[model samples]
Target: MAGGSFALPKPRPSGPPYFSRNQVANVLHQVAVLLELQGANVFRVRSYQNASRLLGSLSEDLGELVASGEIFNMKGIGKGLGSALTQAITEGRWPDDWIDLHTNTPPGLIEMLGIPGLGPKRIKLMADELGVDSVASLKEAALNNQIAPMKGFGAKSQQRMLDGIELLSRFRARRRLDIGLRYGEAFQRKIAAIDGVHRATLAGSARRRKDTIGDLDVVVAVDEADHETVANAILNLSGIADVKGAGDSKISLILDTTIFDESFTVGHIDPNVLDAIGGDDYEQLEAGGTIDAQVRLVPPHVEPFTLAYFTGSKEHNIAVRQRAIDRGLRLNEFGLIPETKAGDLKGMEAAVHSLGAADEAAIYAHLGLAYVPPELREDMGEVLAAETGSLPSLIETSHIKGSLHNHTTLSDGEASLELMADTARKMGWNWLGIADHSPTLKIANGASAEDLLEQGRTIQQYNAEWAEQGVDFRLFHGVESDILEGGKLDHPDDVLAELDYVVASVHAMTKWRGRDEHDNTEELLKVIDHPATTVLGHPTGRILQGREGYEVDLYAVLEHMAEHNEEGRLKAIELNASPYRLDLDWRLCKHAKGLGVPVAINPDAHSIRGLSDIAYGVMTARKGWIEPNDTLNALSGADLAKRLVR
Candidate 1:
């Protein structure tokens, strides 16, 4: 009306633009890589690396630190880096020098950095010595017998380069769950707040909580009279990079992530996550990334049907459509209509009246079935279970009372023990476990037996003090002990017995990956049979899109855990909650539940912010039909204490 036509509300300018902590850290990390590739001073490169690590580990708001100029006071951040960070954080732009370095670097060299086993040093060597800059050129060199003759690289190493290049191609196809949610939820919020939109909800594989997502889908409900206005408003939203298509019912867009408002919580991303999805790709996602999104607009009368149809696994939709056909009805995204001889019922008027459904649940009820949740809509016995009223009471984030697998600065983790405990307490957890890396995992800076015991005493002191103050908080000390050759754990039984529990994980990937599935399964069975082993951590060692994980028959491994658990020994399988490794794959979680083996939803966190990754794990658990009773995270501190005393 003010402009002679309806207009969407403009977002208020919030002074100077500020970047998320993640964005600043990522730019700094990129600068370090670029400098290293250019053979810049080693100390200069190390400064950026240290700054990146420090900023990443910080729980404080980076914008506030920059505003107050307090970041300059931190150790290792000199005036030069501090000014650069200030400009990057407060101005929403990288410094010109850093940009120049990035610009001069070949895009192919950056891509090669992600090709596992290839670091900045080796990549520089290839570019200079063999004229190989990209994966394509590197592959050509390897195929032509040029790489084997190079110094420090033999035939075996040449083959690995070939293998890694193939893996890199697959990583480009889909973004991980966390990255997809960042863009999807951001766009959904923007559209939902528009003037003519009634309600907006995320749909598609993202809504179903799939671990990897291709494109995003958002459904919006609007009155018939407001369709044009709402569609215009969405296309005009600030983050839209391009309008792929616009129609009365559907609008497609390519969203730019870099332009989103500060209201979106761009949380800390683990380095492993960055590596799992290629670093160059993740950097693009953080700095100037674009994702494809479709916004579906439907009238309020058919909103329920539209939402349900769009939030689907195709197989689940087919099953429900078949169910509708069997009952003399035709169900589609518009509405459920009766199978009349005259097909005039295709219009919304006939269908809404015929179905008399107002929501997704009501639609299910009308079909003589209970409502199936979005996560369970994968066509894996859910239709029959809903019909029989036997669907599980799936686990939620609130059901998690504590976690048995976490880390601290004592090992590779970024957060110290005290900070980790405080963060857990703030999350309203009654207990928190510290399972730092054990002695043999040297790469992780594994804690020696002495150091671990010393940390246990500190935890004992904290537990005693909390008890004295009636805080109802406790801490458990554990170690993520490595499972070595022949199934022997990294730490001796004598040392392990001194801890509250033990998390046995495989860090020796080379040896484990060399074995066949049967052998790998047997190795896992031996770890389960160990008297001190409390949980199996990240059972598959898979890094989502990055690695295929070691070959192991997880079903056989779960069976072994089940057998051990039934014998009155406490054994559980960890659903490692890192977005990069939701291992104990969701597909296998139900089998673990069926076998009566408890699932431990471990964050395997390395920082204060990482504790919240449990939310992703909960989504995975619910997808696998796991209930609260089937997971160790749902157990109370006191109850879990008793359960762990094997």
Candidate 2:
């Protein structure tokens, strides 16, 4: 599992595709480790360690910035570490000393560090003192209760380790839903191209729009005579690693992603860094995840019913079948038939029945239920909602008219104001809100007073041009002001009031490591109380796999915001669209909706590519039961402009 051809691209330090922030940060971190291993000066080690963290947290590309000769002006990264990064750029590897020190470390010991929630120091303790060198060994120790006897890792830590290992089994089997969607879409086209194929589409959790996906289920309908030909052709496709099953109706293969899977770009400091960067998680999952496509030869009159039946969530199928029984009809993948005992219909993926054709609505009509969208097919009261007439009219991608709480080169963003606006206009947006960092987050290049004023003037000129061109597109000047340790905005009241919008966010204020919980929630409440505060950006400030959200009474903060919505104070809660920081998380967004607060699905985009993350945010929003009216950016340009000033 450890050995493979490491054809890692030689990172170009100055450009678009440098090694990830995490990879570079990990190098710095490893330098500190190597220095420690060599008994180097404490200050020297601390400097590297600090620089590692600084680069890890950076929103801007440290490589590009450093390559641009800006690292000298930056705080935290001193000359020594900066030189190391510079050397790494040209050498195409970490310093030789780091490699030598890293090689001397015990084999399989790094795997122990892969355990989430456990740092290297602790892993070393286990490796040196307890002889736990691998995950398997660690899990065995935990299961045998041997790990419970350790000094720091007691019974609780032992149990947690065991649970994490169990979770790892599941996590390693599934793909992030976004990745699955890509694979699913690519395969759909390939399957549809099988001659005589009528239709091909994804099923299972991918169809249900789950955040993570297990093995994919694809369903195809074709002519009865073409089933063999279609199945044979798919079995012979290039990149089909192995054929697991080849039946008249089903063709199962392990499609190697090597054909279509791009090198998934990754950032460092992620909890899943080893799994993603090492390509272990990708290999482990795809090696087991099978693509099963069911080709049912059905009449044109019966394809829709077949697709609906095959594209089922098991719970949904059970509910629908129960409904069919109530109506004296039987629902199965085969089609609708007369009511029959379960024993009579066993072992049949296909069956012939009465009173059913292709369309789902017609079948649902027979069962006295409404057609449920595939994404809502989970048994989350959708069936009952269908029975009644109250299904939520979910928000669509088209409903979003603008983006808010965005960043540009004025702050840490890689793109400029002109570029951000161009990207927004291309996406059919009527307006955009640029809430660059206020002067507190030195790490994110928070704008100074002069910088904000200059950006404001630039936005003014852009607006004038927009008016001149008779274009609806407009830009709202805003600031993502930091909330200081207490409750004050990073920028002055006079400064914040000058902007069209304000986004007060907790940067250093939240004691994410658990120093203060009650106070942190109170700090957020006070920020929300500010009359100019527009949206609470990433309310929890969590990186999903990397870091837990800062401790705060989220429900209490949301309730407080709801009570203070009179003058549109804390007007909207942001569903920040970064893959790592999907905060306020969907669960909390649902609560916000219940509290009558609208959610804004902001990409929190620092670059143009970041704008595409809106889809992920929208998916999270849909999961939160947010509708167009429940979202703030659904407002048009003029309306949003008016609201921001109000």
Candidate 3:
């Protein structure tokens, strides 16, 4: 559709692209669920579930696979499911004969499965007994005592159903930060390219780089007269699935996205695309997720005003407004102006005399404050810091010297060690730390001691060869040693001591599973006290939307490390750069820095391409006011070695 386009002759698609790999998988999954609800054959239902997962884990594009006639030979694809995937991709639905089956159940009934104590049998009972078809109806029945009188339904079960609804409601409200940005930026760019648009910038928590975002706010500037043109331009964008409203000044819409064209190209392979297909931390950009989007257009003079106003933590804006009031001025989305009584002024936009409003820095200057970065706009003493000229120079991506928590093909990573090292070298770094997982975490195919020693020899040879070539890049070997439930390390101290650094982490049984938060806290304390443990990997063991962090007193853990840092034990906490798991979240980074604890903005990358996530980590660290001095990886290899305990 751009420079050139060629149609693939075989596997002719009957329609334009509609379903992404995720959508195809979801359709199969939904079919399986609906069949089970209706009591279909167990084996038949299980087959659909298996195919859904197989598709979810695929690297190849489903449409292209069908187009290439490769679906028939693919593993885990039986004839029934193969036909269904291709049908869903091209036709956007299952076969005509199956339409009734797909639509037989009310869509909301599937959501009931998410409630912890509810299953198909319970749901079927509820449907039959209460005539419930949606969460709303189910809630009504529970509240009305309709289900409590039925068999196997009592006060506790009704209470659980109510609790599950509350939890799902919260999760439904906002998206994790990276997820929103991944989808928002694409439309932001597309809208800014429209004819009447002069500029486009994402505001709200996205611009401020918060850990999670409620919605994306985009503000643009255009000629005063081009407002409608820009608004309609936003309405027509491909992924703008639903328009909530539209106006001259602003428009609200729902954005549903799959992997954008910029992120995925079927049948096209590149050497640099680690995690190119499916690996940890990699998914379709948006993965066909949905988020709320707001687009607004303003006059050039009011561009900075609206941007700052919209890109605010409510409290941050309140602080700025109060400061303006004290100085005989007022601020709003329109612009900054002389103080006006309600009766004397039409609005903030109608001011006759203006202080400057063309840029955020100018607005801050007029208010007698330094330009605050979006990351620091949390109103967390930033206003006073701005007043006293004591604001910090937040760390940037360039400040990171090299990453310390990286993975390779040796353990659940997409790229091989050679590939990962080559990528690190290309980034102009002096060294790269490779910390594969321990053997006990067999799900990642963790490395044994023999494998570690063999990898060490391979690294030494590569270093020797690269040295002769004058590349000057060195490799450091280590393991992401698992911290078991009891706080003991998966590897022996001897094995840990053989490496450059041991990144101790809790990968499984992290939740407050029948144990006190104090138990988890003490567990981490013991692990951190291990002489061989150098950094804590994802101190929280959180996977963003998928899993909450384990229960533990993180503050106590950070305090413990602060006291131990001088001893060269547990030198840093990982700012895991994986979009899904930016653990040791930026909010806590500042506290760690204050405690004299260092951090490593490690990509926790599974492949070379995944290394780019370091940029996100750097931004997150900035949000916590972390500086170069607060990061261990900001050091040269030699200095880093000196900083570590022998």
The global Cα lDDT (0 to 1) of model 3 is 0.75
List residue ranges in candidate 3 displaced over 4 A.
1-172, 262-288, 340-343, 510-512, 568-570
Over the stretch 384-430, how does candidate 1's per-residue lDDT look in tens digits? 99999999999999888889889898988999999999999899888
Tens digits of per-residue lDDT for model 3 on 1-646? 0001111112213343345555566656766777887778888888888777667645465668887768878867868777866776666656653566655777667777755468777888889778988889999999998888899889988987887676444333456666678767887888888998889999999999977777789999999788877777677778765565688788877676632545432221212222322344334433544577888788777889899999997668988999998998778888788765433675543554566666899999998899999999877788999989988899888777788988888888889998888888788778899998889888778899889878888887887887799876788778888888667887777767777788887766534444556677888999888788888988876665455555566778889998897655556888887766777776578788889898888888887878878888988999888888889877887787666545
What are the models' TM-scores?
0.72, 0.67, 0.71
RMSD, each candidate, Å?
A: 21.0, 17.8, 19.1
Question: Model 3: what TM-score?
Answer: 0.71
Candidate 1 has what TM-score?
Answer: 0.72
| Model 2 Cα shift for residue 645 (angstroms) | 2.7
List pairs with backbone clashes in candidate 2. 22-268
Task: Please give the ranking of all candidate structures by lDDT, highest first, separated by commas.
Answer: 1, 3, 2
lDDT of 1: 0.82
Which RMSD does model 3 reach against the true structure?
A: 19.1
What clash count goes with each model?
0, 1, 1
Q: How accurate is candidate 2 locally (lDDT)?
A: 0.70
Q: What is the lDDT of residue 209 in candidate 1?
A: 89
